[model samples]
Target: MRIALAQINPVVGDLLGNADRIHAALAATEVNGKVSADLLVTPELSLWGYPPRDLLFSAAHLEQQQQALDQLQQRLHAEQLDVALLVGVAEVAPDQQHPRLFNALALVQARGWQVVARKQLLPSYDVFDETRYFRASSSPSTLSLRVNNRDWQLGLSICEDLWVDEELHGQRLVGPDPIASLIPERLDALINCSASPFSRRKGTLRHELAARAAERLQCPVVYVNQVGGNDELIFDGASFVIAPGDDTPLLQLPEFAVSTEVWTAASSTDRLEQPSRAHQQANTPDDDLEALFRGLVTGVKDYATKCGFKAALLGLSGGIDSALVAVIAAAALGPDHVQSLLMPSPWSSSGSIADALALATRLGIASQIVPIQTLMEGFEATLTPALNAEPSGITAENLQSRIRGTLLMAMANQQGQLLLSTGNKSELAVGYCTLYGDMNGGLAVIGDLYKSTVFALCHWLDSPDAGACRAELGLGGSGPLIGQAILEKPPSAELRPDQKDSDSLPDYERLDPLLMDLIEQRMSGEQLIGAGHDPDDVKRIERLFRRAEFKRRQAPPLLKVSKQAFGSGWRLPIAAI
Candidate 1:
């Protein structure tokens, strides 16, 4: 039997649009007249979209979804298509209070939807709070049918249902295997509908888990995932099929696009194809650098599109931070809408301006050279008396950065473009970045990536056919968009004349790991020092990280690409030390 799997991305609460898109994919399959196909399946919550969030309580959202389902039933009957449809949507039960809704999947035949499988497992762990809305199904559901005049049995499962082997108990962890129960079922295949979120290296874990289950059940498994950028989450849509024997991968689909493939029971015996290597498709394996790039692109595109802004503005220091942000902005909103500003002070190096201009030329982005010497002088004259007793310390240095930042924000205000901040994770972690200066912006492009990772991504973008657009500035060659000097030169804040970043902080190789431990892992100083770091170095790094909390707190929301990031996930006291 030929089964058509529709891989699609749907917007939350847009029931009509989501249903229309589903019908369109179904129509494409119908044009072929079902042929030998007997079933068509779509991703989880494809009807109302995934994580309807609080919209589940809205009277309009629930009403529209139910109405859409009814309309779809009429269409199915009117078309007289014999194909059976399996889909996911939100359903409200008879309970009058305290969330009577459920995350459910429905099987619709020519007559009507005969079976409804409510989600048996509600996820309530890091980044998931399904327990706040859904209730677990008390029993299992099976779909029994006949295709090609033959009988077939299939078991139903949702996203969190397969991952219930682990649990939480206050501050401790618990274990109970959920997939184990489903493994003993006597069935021909198990079909899973999911709205899984994208993370680094998630595809591998997903494949391994499904393959193990298929082997245990001795049946082929079809896994479908939702794709698209929904607010803070991005679903890497790479749905595939895995057979039990030899665990051959029958098929693999594309990412960030909607496509359908036929999964034949006969082809399941014909030849199972080998799994493709990482980087074979547009986005997989979630390479740290590649994932960082995609996250930045998505953040920029969404921030711009949602806020109704068409252009972005940023001050371009000859340093790596601004250069990286510029390239990301160009890739996101296109070169035509991104602008680079070079606001050099008296201390600014000629090489810095040249490098900034060169990069702007390479990316075909417009640039304006605004000199800030007079502005800096005015601020110094006004604040010198108050600063003379303390001498030139952090305050004086911060004034210079604030001047440049003010200039960039002014440009953005005048042109109605969103300002992009260029501070990176390393500088932001050590309190080295100037608050209200370089930290002012709507969204952070690479806030989740460390400095070393940033350098790696810059080099990666220069490679051939890595999806980077050609340089239109006539600088020659389509090599990576960032200037070569930016990658090789030592990182610097450039607050004063020739100030290198390493002069104060440890080398990024040492700094990033410490920052990762402190910020991402939330490891204490004693624990980190026990891990072979120098005591003095650990104390200094800890001090920097703790002091910088105030800066990060006021900074723009970071785009999360790691298991742990600075904002909402990592909660700690700034004065804990």
Candidate 2:
């Protein structure tokens, strides 16, 4: 059997557009003509979107979905396409006696459509509220189709259905051995339509799980996923097919883009197109740079596109964070649309101005040199005498940042561009950044990325593979725009003279791993200390992390690239300590 995985990104409510995308996918593969497959699989909720959330309650949305499905069925019949389309949607059980809707898959056959049962498990933990909207089904859904003169029996499952064994938030959430029920009756394949979110090292984990399932089921498994960004979520579309008997994937599709690949048992010749390896390599300079750059570009484009903004503006401080944000802005919005404001202060050095101009010139974006020294003087005049004998420390330094922040916001307001915040995860975690100062922006690009990761990404962008075309056309030069100096220079805030980030915070070499353990792995301070991390360092970092919650609460909505991000997923009290 040759099946096509239609990896698609659909807007949350546009049923027509979603159906159109599904039609386009069907036409591309000509599911009935060249390749005779029993089924064509699409991502979960391909019609109404993965998690329609509160929108599911509206009668209008549900009516539109039914109408769209009717139209889809009519179109399929009109085209005389004999292939069975297994698609995910918000299914309303005829019995409407059921209180909630079901996260469902409906198999549209040549004759008519039938409900292939709703999800047995409705996930309700962190970032998911499936239980709030969807009601669980009692039995497995089995469907039969005739393909290539043979009857093909198949089973359907949605995103969270396959992971029955996994405990979510310390609670076991699903039935035991959901896949085992299908074993009693012979089945050709298991098609899972998913809308899984992206996270570092998640792909490897998914692959392992899929392989294990395939081995247990003794049938080929087709995994189709949604792509593109929806609100704070980004769906990485590295869909693949696993052969039952073999460990290697039979077919693989690329990530963060729309792609299609066919998988067949009899066909000995098949090629694999994998997702970008930039995220997989943590230590490699080139790959890390490409990953971070791509992540930022996606972040900028999606945040602007989804939020209805066209242009981006940022403060260029001649530092790596600002430089990286500038490059990402250029890539996302065209150079004509990306505006850089050089907010040099009285404390700012000449070398900073020189480097900022050099970068702006290389990138060919509009640049404005705004001297914030006057603004700093005005702030000092206002605050000096009010302070009796308090030492001038972080408060004084923050005044400079606030001045620059005001100037950047002024530019963004004048030019109608969204200001991109340049503070990274490391600084944000420890409250190293100033609220309403460096923290002011519409979207926080690379806010989820660590400081050390930012350096690695800069180095990668300077390498050869950085030659990949800018996501937007007619913006960047053919090759990389990052300079060797930007990649090699020591990272600093430049808020104070001769201040390096290392002066206060732990070295990134030590910092990022500890953060990964603490945040991503959810390890306690004692656990980190037990795992060879210094106890004092862990204690300090933990303290900083706990204290910074209030600042993060005020921070703009951040683009999430990790499993546990400071954004919506990692919700905690401001004073947890």
Candidate 3:
């Protein structure tokens, strides 16, 4: 059987657009003679896009989806494409008693399209809320196709269906073993369609799961995933195939980009003797940071592009957070399309402005210096009558950020550019960010990156290995693109005189580790203190973290690069103690 994996990027709620994307890919491969395969597979919910969330509940959305599938089948038939393509869909179960929709896979051939598979193992934990939208399938879905006068049976699973290794997890997740059930029936290949979100080092987990399923079934596993950003969730389309008992992947697709590749396999009687080379091999540990950077860039680009913004602008403070955002934006939207505003207040150091300019120059991006001092004085003067006193202390400090935020917003609105927010995890975790001030952006580019990881990524960008990535992204400068000044300087809001972040929060070196334990590991305050974290600081940070829930709820959607980001997955009650 010859199979093609379409690792695609689909925007949520864009059913017609997603169908068009699938058609375009199929046509491109046909024209280039690269998709002359028996079967084609796309990611989960490729028609309506993944993480449709509440959009699935809308009868109108479901109606659009059905129309899209009809249109897709008509196009495929009209074009006379002979390839059998398995595209994901959202199907309304005929039985009205069940959940309205079943996350399904439809097999589209030249004649028509049919729902061949429905997803089981609906994961409600973490970022996934499929239970609210999709009904879990009670039985396995298998498809038999006759090619070259031989019958081939393919086991079909979607996303969480193949992730049923309870033994590895130390406990069961209260689900039937989808993979094990397929083993008894005997299959040619197991194809899994996934819209799996990206997290740091998540590729390993995927590889293990696929490999394990292949081992259990003694069949080749084809895993195709959605690639791109949908809100805060980033789908790292590191799609691959694993032969039975193979420790390493047979064919690994590229990460952070759309990829389509064809793999030809014999029937079960004649299995592949050796593993096939990956279409795009995984450069594992070495390229982890590169992958993360690429993921963020893709997220920003997709978010901006899909949201209908061609250009992006951000408030480029001389701080590391904004600098990183600028770099990411420049890479994502291109230097010509990305703009920056150095909104320096009177308290802002001269070097801060200079550093922002240097970064802009290094990135070859357009920027303007918009001083907030005048605006600050005017705001204070205007608000004095309403306040009954001068806007002083933290109020005065946050005013500067608001002024800059407002200026950036004005620039974005007038110029029609998406504004990028530049706050890090450390600041967001402890409520150090000013709401409606520096937190104003169409998308929070680095909201998931801890302060330390931001520094490390920047350092990695300056390293020799980053040349290819920098060049690929159209970044210039033979020397450090981020520069030593911006990197070596202590992080600060620069809203007030000598306003170092250290004054309010612990140094990133200490803060990030404690944060990882508390947020990602979900350690209790006592557990955190027991793990050698400072007790008072732990208590203080805990209080701050809890208090900041309201702010986070109001903040712009942030890019999720970590395991436990403050976006969709972090569902802490704001009114809780």
Candidate 4:
């Protein structure tokens, strides 16, 4: 059977727009007034986009989805297309229950569309609240298709349905195994439509899951994923098809982009052979750094574009974090559209200022120097009367950061640009960053990346391995984009004289691992100590992390790139110990 995987990017709540995208995909995959493939599949909830959240609660939104599906059917019939299209939709439950919706797939032909498959495993973990929005299906869904004078039994599964291996995930969802259910059906091929978000090395896990399912069913497995950024979630559509018994994929789609390609499976009577090593090498998974860079670029670009902003503004402090954000902004929105303000305070080193300017020059992005020394004196003068003393120590230091943040926001507002926050995960985790100061922006570009990860990504960006990626991202020049000076310089806020991050917090080399354990692994102080972390250091870091909940709660939404990020996934009580 010939199947076309439509790896598409859908805008949330833009029902007609998404349908138009599907229509365009159909047109692109056609040959002389007929679709070349026997079936076309789109990602989960392709009609409404993924994680519509509260948008699902609106009756008008659901009605609009039905209208969009009707329009797509009409277009297909009007165009005389002869292919069965599998598009994701939210099926209204007939029983009119509390949730009243099922995350489902609709089989669209020229005449009309019908809901064929409903998702069974509704994930409620980490950034996903599927249980709150959708009711699970009790049984597996299967479809019998007649193509090319032959019968094919196709198994249908949604995003989380294929993730049933306990060994791979360390734990399994408590429900019927979708893969095991299909084993009794003797399926010809399995298709998983998903809107899985991007996380480091998640593509590997996806491949393993698909490969295992294919092996168990003794058939080929096709995985199609949604691509683009929706709010804090960024979906990396690394869609692929894996033949049974082979861990390597026979066909692989590009990551972090929209693509549609047709894959032809061998007849049921014949065995599906694995692809040659040369082909396998060509379709190998991307380097983690490359995926990380592309994911951030996609997040920034989509967030700005979807939110109706053409330009971006950020405070470029010569520090590595800000420097990386500047580069990402330039790549996402063209360098011409990304502007930066070098808000140098009295404590800002001349070398740092020069380095910031040089890096901006290399990137071809516009930069402006906004000195804040005069503003600092004005603030002290204004507040001294009420306090009977000048703001000193941490208060004075935070004043500098706030001053810079205010300038960036003003410029962004005046120019109608999106403001990008440059704080990294480590600073945000330990409350090393100032709330309403460095945390001020429409989106936090690197808030999910640890300090160590930020440094590593920068180093990779400078290396030759990133050449192809840089070219694809339209980053100019072959020379190092981030200078050695910025990479080698110690991390500092520059709010105080010679302010080093290490002065208040442990070294990032030690702190990031502990933070990862505490946050992502959810390790307690005792567990951390048992794992060989210093008891005193663990206690101090844990206290800091817990105390920073209030600040994180007030911070702007950050792009999610890790398994756990501070955005929607990290749920903790602010009043707790």
* Candidate with best lDDT: 4
> Model 3: residues >4 Å from true position, as ranges?
31-35, 167-172, 272-286, 385-388
How does model 3 score by TM-score? 0.96
Better of 1 and 3 by TM-score: 3
How far off is residue 527 in model 3, in Å? 0.5
Give candidate 1 regions above 4 Å deviation.
28-37, 96-99, 108-110, 113-115, 164-176, 245-248, 266-288, 380-392, 413-416, 465-477, 573-577
TM-score of each: 0.86, 0.88, 0.96, 0.98
Model 3 per-residue lDDT tens digits across residues 374-476: 8888999999999999999999988888888888899899999998999988888889988889889889888999999999999988888888888878886
Give lDDT tens digits, candidate 2, residues 252-358.
77777776555553321221223122112122112434554555576678778867788989988888888888888887777878888898876677887888888
Candidate 4 whole-model C-alpha lDDT, 0 to 1: 0.90
**Every candidate's CA RMSD:** 4.4, 4.8, 2.0, 1.6
Candidate 4, 1-577: lDDT as tens digits: 7888899999998888999998787767766766788899999999888878999998898889989989988987887867789999998888977788899999998889899999999999889899998899999999988898988899999999999998897777899999999998878789999999999999999999899899899988989999999999999998998887787687788888888888887776674553322223243336999899999999999999999999999888899999999999989999999898998888999989999999999998999998999999999999999999999999999898898888888889999999999999998999988887888999999999999999999999999998888987889537899989999999988888888988998899999999999989999999999988888889999989989999999989999999999988888889997
Error of 4 at 565 (Å): 0.6
Give all candidates' CA lDDT scores. Answer: 0.73, 0.75, 0.86, 0.90
| Highest-TM-score candidate | 4
Checking candidate 3 for backbone clashes, the offending pairs are: none
Clashing pairs in 2: 289-457
Q: What is the lDDT of residue 109 in candidate 3?
A: 82
lDDT measured at residue 86 in model 4 versus the true structure, 0 to 100:
96
